[model samples]
Target: MTLAIERPVGVFGRKDLPDDWAHEQVTYFQDPETGLRAIVAIHDTTLGPALGGTRFYPYEDESVALTDVLRLSQGMTYKSAVAGLPLGGGKAVILGDPATMKTQALLEAYGRFVQTLGGRYITAGDVGTNSDDLDVIGRVTEHVVGRNVAAGGSGDSAPMTALGVFQAMRAGARAVWGVPSLAGRTVGVEGVGKVGYQLIDLLIADGASVVAGDVNSSALERVVHDFRGVRTTGSIIDLDVDIYAPCAMGAILTGGAVVDIRAKLICGAANNQLAHPAVERQLADRGITWVPDYVANGGGIIQVAGERESAAMDQVRARVEKIFDTTVEVLDTAKREGMLAGAAADTVAEARISSSRARRTSPCTR
Candidate 1:
């Protein structure tokens, strides 16, 4: 149950990075009354602000929690830059079960930790954190997103997120199969959470048949009832479908899931889809096209970062449509270079970051 695993060398070792890119910092928060402990890791600020969601989970070890925060925050950096946002990356992790240890005090304490960083990092809701939990953090600082509508914030990112994933899925399908629409195609959605359910809805509306699964019986039932064309299954990943949308937790695509996957294209809103780089390679070897999670699932961040909500949503839709173009581009690049989709994604992201930096620092801009 150790959270620590083999990772890129400098990912956790921030000291090795150049000073300009090495603003990586970590804060520890503890509420003696509630016995709640959490860690917030801010990765970089090359763009503008550091933005990432806060996740609450029962992490087995401190290192595992730290690693998750680091990797996710860095991924946020790439995601924002690639999506043409002015934010960097940061993330927070509470090493406890959300269903059991979550409390207002814990969230407030975590928000205080965020306050300590001034305005360098902003927090939003992740897998284990919700809008209600974010409301607690909002009491401590304005550096929070995903606030409830009653609180003058966009509470649920599910619909926007699902739209982005659907756009990416469409792009992937068209690029790979030359089909411009999802109609009549079978899509397997793993996890019928807020995002997953909406994704299923969009797919079904577009004439795509969906088979869904979730650990929550109520959620599964709701999806099945609302979408008459939809079917339910015990295990989501094992479903035989043309496309597999993973809206659940990270690392689900690791190990046997990669090899056993029957889907032609893998795309979803799940962060860190591949358990490791090797799994990315395995997907490539299996000829499964993958839309990088950070790139495909960046609509939520883009929506929250911009000032104009409607404009942001429109841009999110447009950007997500480009995921198809990017996916096709990456696939072509990989086939020519004999590389994995993940590596190609990294190359593209890195180049975009570099180009953005150069454009910003150019003499003409000055």
Candidate 2:
């Protein structure tokens, strides 16, 4: 049986998130002692406890923040399912400018909220947050993980995410061509944040011409200073490049841009790249091969989960390296079944999750 959540009627005067965002739990938290306003959305726990990073951003209002957390937590559920992790998906978002409002008291208060859920959701770092921040959260709750290596946790997920995108981009290229290589290919990357910057390092080293863009001038300047000869684009999405990597935020494929997209492939570290759930068909219709964002960005979660299990770098990287093969499999399944790759990937994930759920609930015990 499926559960249907009531839409936020007249809340934003428009539907902000997708219709499919019927989550298992959507929780709002506020601490007057620390001035913390947050939302935590748990999408599923059929596979295991939900594990996802907690993002901190200065959203315009509570409606916008709720919309973001709902979509992001749902994406994490799909991401975890498709990545073959033994965990489910959930996410927390702290609604504030991290630079101005982040304090130990606030994080500890937020940690208290996490503990109230009793480990059904785990929080890490995303956007304005960092590993040190998770360490602070950990001090208040055992549900939190993904701290710095010195703090007995995975150090950073940015590099792992970059590596995964780079590998999966090659796989996308190979599905179009006959080989997995990006040499001499032009790749446009939007958003030069931690993961985007690391991805640039791999692309340049792989001999691909890089075009970069960001709203922040400092980010663009850092890219120009670190890597010369790379083209800086006014609009990264409109670049006439071989591949388009949207590493910033989600919903890049909305607003009629999908029809005129010139890129041969779309593979990036961003989650929920599709604004609409059905947008994968649009990419397929446009003849653009898209490695589902979750599959491509699974490396970060893989790293964090492995580290939580006390796995070494070799083990973690070995698992992350499988993303290439998984990319190929998803594309091939889509092609053979005449469906969108994202949908095909969802089929695979749902099958695995269903089997797990059935086994967990069956009373045919020995």
**lDDT (10s digit) by residue, model 1, range 40-108:** 777767677788888898987776676677767778887887776778788888888888888888788
| Candidate 2, 1-366: lDDT as tens digits | 111122463223334544543578878899998999989988889888898989899987786677677767877887788888898989889999999999999999999999999999988778988889988988889887778888888887889889999889988998997779999899999889989999999999999999998988889899999998887865788678899999997777764778778899999988778877556666777788888888899888888888768899889898888899889999889889988888788888889888998887789842
Residue 46 miss distance in model 2 (angstroms):
0.8
Query: In angstroms, how far off is 170's CA in candidate 2?
Result: 1.1
TM-score of every model versus the real structure: 0.87, 0.93
Cα misplacement distance, residue 266 of candidate 1 (Å): 0.7
Displacement of residue 250 (Cα, Å) in model 1 is 1.2
lDDT of 1: 0.77
Q: In model 2, how large is the Cα lDDT of residue 183? A: 93
